[model samples]
Target: MKLYQPGDTSRAICPHCGKLVSTTFAYRDVPFEDGSGVVKGILAAVCDECQNVIAIPAQSTPAIRRARDAAEISLEVSIPAPEVEILDAAAYRVDPSATTRFRKSLFAFYLQRLRHSEETAEMLRRDFEAWNAVKTEQRKRVSRGIRIPHRRLSFKISPKTDRDVQWLMETSGMNKTDTVRSVVMEIEKDLLGPNTPRELRHLQDIAAVVNA
Candidate 1:
């Protein structure tokens, strides 16, 4: 199967819009069953004009074969109940991305159904209210401009600790960075209660600077 390397662009007719468009090849995370797991290096053709994915037969054939093999292996293995629940939740989880197309598509689908049924309308109304609440909180944080900046931290750990981290990744469905952050939060809660004096002083300092 021929694949386009990085910095290569090919002209193709976009199936979605029926227009001749430039297709850019990029490596994207192809999720297995929504987002249960991701195959990190899948080659895909994305149309520049329509912002839609163009189907490539050669690339898809091998992916389909690998998916079948993985599915068979998954059926043969036994997963713990807690792990299974985590995997199930991960399947529907969405990451923060450049585009909200998936979310918009879901909203459109629900909105269409709502026109025919009162129950659907009620559900959609509640969903919007919940979403708005989250947005409102985020906006408040942004307006305050006192959010801590994230920094990269690196350290070496023993093999036992590495194994524990792997276990936490499986159980919590968090990447290593997030798992470490969660551990730190738990430790802080235990040691300093919900609000630490140091943190309060730091925030106060920032507030004073902003006020000035």
Candidate 2:
């Protein structure tokens, strides 16, 4: 691979100009594709015409990845043992060798996907209402019967994901705890299904890197 340096010139297709154009390598602050965050002062190929960072060198990949990891925030929640197990089961089903880390990745993936649909708020409300009913019955059982166990699950997530969860809360009328559980409920139904989804390939790919 060629190592780029400041003032180095090359010919590359610039998306902004919509054609092949001259580019000059320089260190610049580049935003991630999703616009969630920016990686500062990374070496990139800037289009001569539009002044946009057109192509990044292979060597800058690690620095960009580090910026992403640094921006992560921990997402933690406490839920019943069964719900946690369901999440882990989904992870294992995605990749037989996946560990607990993959479980968090799986749920994070589901949470991110849920925010894309307009109907997610309604679905989450239904799931949470059903869980509320179950909890009410469980309390009655606990009065005369056995105790239920709970566990704490935690993982690192991006700020955008945190924002999405908050948005879901506002739309669905569920608190953070119930919101996460409702996500897990959806994860269980999709991941533990009889037929593997086409998106399973993407999930498996994530699991591979996550559990690596």
Candidate 3:
């Protein structure tokens, strides 16, 4: 998508020269038909007076659309976890139920927020703990495994249209062609559904072919 915030000017004092500089930055989505099938864009910022080019973040621009879309569909709410009681070995042995009680208290507090009581809290806590443990184990499994390396390659594009790739890149904060290619690649992947793994393998093969 093209991103242009025309007439959006912010006054800021530059830390380097201590001069008030008017910053005009454009975000463009650049396309990448290379390996990884990743969407990459360029967020180029130029100092109006100094003519100094500052890249806002190539990764940021490239990743922004995907991240924003992900955020929109995500149900990842950040609620603080309940505080746990840390006791010495001797104390813990003396009061074995202390830890469980602390957990119980936390559940109670959480239940109260949900308009539930201690009775409901105890059941919810057990269920939550079970789910939490499963997630933790999955995390451990993923982390403990060594990751496989992927290949990277570069390729050229055909630009026979009047569509100004530079203009699209600067205004939309995306690589015009690369962004389009990336989006098409993603859509193709999504359409693959249950055969995503196979599709990904095919992608790797295609990447190799592109390089060859």
lDDT of each prediction vs. the true structure?
A: 0.45, 0.85, 0.37
- Give TM per candidate: 0.28, 0.78, 0.19
Q: Which one wins on lDDT?
A: 2
lDDT digits (tens) for residues 13-78 of candidate 1 = 898989888988776656555333445566777787876667553766587557544543110123
Which structure is stronger by TM-score: 2 or 3? 2
1-212, model 3: which lDDT tens digit per residue?
Answer: 44546334555555555677887765444333322232334454556777554334444553755643332311111221211111112123323333332322222222223222444334433444464476457656875875433222112222211123233334334343332322222232233335534333443343344334
Q: Of models 1 and 3, which has the larger lDDT?
A: 1
List runs of model 2 lying over 4 Å from the truth.
116-120, 135-149, 189-212
Model 1 residue 113 CA deviation in Å: 29
Ranking by TM-score: 2, 1, 3
Off by over 4 Å in 1: 1-3, 31-39, 57-60, 72-212
- Listed per candidate, the RMSD to the true structure in angstroms reads 22.6, 3.4, 24.2
lDDT of 2 at 82: 75
Q: What lDDT tens digits, residue by residue, belong to model 2 across residues 54-160?
A: 99999999999999998888888898887898898888888999888787777778788778565878877887788668866876777576656789988787888
Poorly placed runs, candidate 3 (over 4 Å): 1-7, 28-41, 53-212
Q: For model 3, what is the error of residue 128's alpha carbon versus the real structure, in angstroms, after optimal superposition?
A: 43
